[model samples]
Target chain A: MLKRLAEVLRGMGHRIIDRIWRLGSGARFFLYTLIYSGESFRRIHLTIREIYFTGVMSLLIILVSAFFVGMVLALQGYNTLQKYGSSEAIGVLVALSLVRELGPVVTALLFAGRAGTAITAEIGLMKTTEQLSAMEMMAVSPIARVVAPRFWAGVVSMPLLAALFSMVGVLGGYLVAVPVIGVDNGAFWSQMQANVDFQADIVNGVIKSVVFGVACTMIALFEGFDAPPTAEGVSRATTRTVVNSSLAVLGLDFILTSFMIVT
Target chain B: MERTTMDLWVGIFAVAGAAALFGLALKVGNLTSSSVGDTYTVTAAFENIGGLKPRAPVKSAGVVVGRVDNIQFDSKTFEAKVTLKVDKRYPFPKDTFANIYTAGLLGEQYVGLEAGGDEQPLKDGDKISHTQDAVVLEKMISQFLYNKASESDDSKKAE
Candidate 1:
């Protein structure tokens, strides 16, 4: 049994190494494709469509969720601060935490799970049905026709969605503070405005969103293109796209934060 | 089939709108320092700084008049020297006192300045004479728990 366990461990290690190799090669290929492409305008157009669908459409949900998130944060923060006789700093805490970290990261993860999966499934289905092949035969570049638009869309939509999330979150916090937490509305907004810097929170939120957009688009596209031509394959690809894109968004957020902090 | 100019215009509008909104948000947030006015500085010394960091607000009578700019340790006194930037309009007397207070149970610290009624206005680089150290929540909770345990032990001994 011990010998069997050792063999399994060795096999797992090799499989992990092989997976890493494939991921590295895949990333290189993607970079090459992007750099070598002459038809970036076409991708930009597709990106607009993605922004409209992913960003504008998702605005209401993001706003609602952010509002509640802000409210909860304010309520919890107020309670804690009140104990220390410093309930007034609730605005600063909510604004900073929401804009700096939660706003863009949470919105991007939601987008990845929702729209990213849809893009992968749609493209995977097209590939399996040979629609992509037909487009190629008809003198349309599959990369230009399909991938460019989706990629651009992801890029454009993410920042806008994040902004919406931040705004809604602040408003939500306001609602909780004034009505439930018993903080005066004017005091709440004034404190928030005083404490929060537009450049640090808003700009950072948008920048993170843009990065998330690119990450989500790339992960979805990669999964779709590499999917095996089977029904189960398409389903698996969609699942992988969502999970991988969400993880990538979080990882990228950390890297971006480190860079932002240093520079 | 070719796409119409109208389609291109619509796409441009969408992107432009998103960018415009982002720009507006930046403006509203005042993230740009260009809008900020002249800053004035004051100094305070604390025995224990706790979690007091730079950018913590300096409040006078529950209204923020300035922010903590920097914190450094004085090796001779074993205390923290915190510098604050107050608005030009707000003046502090030379005998003012600064206290480090927690804003919540989570123990986010801020500087509270109690203005003195002394005849002379505090000039720049003047140090506030009286300072109170921060009272952290964790320390208070631990102390409470220790007392409770000791009291329980005493009751058992009495029994």
Candidate 2:
């Protein structure tokens, strides 16, 4: 019994130490990626191709989900606000909610599922197929060649996707509120315009999306880079990418919202 | 996909994204509406600020002419000092009365500038002497109740 307890304690300590070591390595990987990102700009076509793959391909899903989210926000907001006879304020509710919180967060979440998984899988497969090793053998850094463009593409795409989400979502809300629910069209647009300040609401949302972009893309790249060179390992790394990116986006959202709201 | 085709798609995506952001700024935000140009700062002191906040609109005759810049508390005089940034085109006189008014029932509070007929226009860092405190509901109710009580006491003494 004493020997078994000692072995359990030792195992727990090893796992904890391993986790800390991996975390440290992940940070180092992030720093290395940033340092090597110079090549991505120099070879602009690479980043553009990645943007075409990650951003352009992901636009359809982003717009569709955003529309639905906005419609739901309007329907729900109108139900509550009409009770107080302030249904005209529905535009403000939807716009503020989307621009401040939902646009960046939901876009980040969707981008993680749509583009992040693809990035992780592609990179992980390259590693599994020994392509990364071959490139390294041929004096080409995989971080610069494979990872940097994707990273920059993600960082660029995130804010645009978020902005598109907010804009489309507001239109969806307008559709539901004005035509379907008999709300005045003028009031809808005017209320939203009056209450949503450009600098405070729209600019802050862009900032949040940029931060989320960095976080989501970095996690995906790190997972792919760190995956064991095996089929099962690459698959597990893909799953971890989604899980880690989602959690990071949410946790960072709370922290970012706290910082944004105080100002 | 062909490189040129992919480039075209990316170009479209980029343009669409830019258009969406521009539309949001124009249609859903106060970017164009609240662009007061070349503002001059002025200050006013009030006994109570109520729910007045920074960036609240400063309207003259129901038209927004400026924005509230900052709010500070003066411990010496026990008044709230509010700084206003008014547009240069719509200048108020030195004797302009600054009154805190609510837009509508349950709406945000704003500063209303009722311009005084004076030849001298207010400049930056100038102070407005004529000011009205924001009406506190509780204070007004208490004052009304006190008046009623005093009136009944007088009636009883006369009887």
Q: Please, what is the whole-model Cα lDDT of each candidate in the order they appear? A: 0.77, 0.92
Give a tens-digit lDDT track for model 2, residues B16-112.
Answer: 8888899889988888765657899999999999999887888899887988889999999999999999999997888899999976566668999
Candidate 1 error regions (>4 Å): A1-25, A36-38, A42-44, A72-97, A138-140, A186-208, A230-232, A247-263, B1-36, B44-51, B74-79, B93-108, B114-120, B125-159
Name the top lDDT candidate.
Answer: 2
What is the clash count of model 1?
8
Model 2 residue B146 CA deviation in Å: 2.6
lDDT by residue (A1-263, candidate 2, tens digit) is 99999999999999999999999999999998899999667998999999999999999999999999999999999999888788888999999999999999999999999999999999999998999999999999999999999999999999999999999999899889999998988778766876898988999999999999999999999999899989999899999999999999999999998998899
**Model 2: what TM-score?**
0.85
Cα lDDT of model 1 by residue, A152-191, tens digit: 6677677767776776777788778888778867656655
Residue pairs in candidate 2 whose N, alpha carbon or C atoms collide under 3 angstroms: none
Model 1 pairs in collision: A46-A149, A47-A152, A47-A153, A80-B105, A81-B104, A86-B103, A198-B31, A199-B31
**Docking quality tier of candidate 1?**
incorrect
Q: What is the TM-score of chain A alone in each candidate?
A: 0.88, 0.97
Please state the error at residue B118 of candidate 2 in Å. Answer: 9.4
DockQ for each model: 0.18, 0.57
Clashes of 2: 0
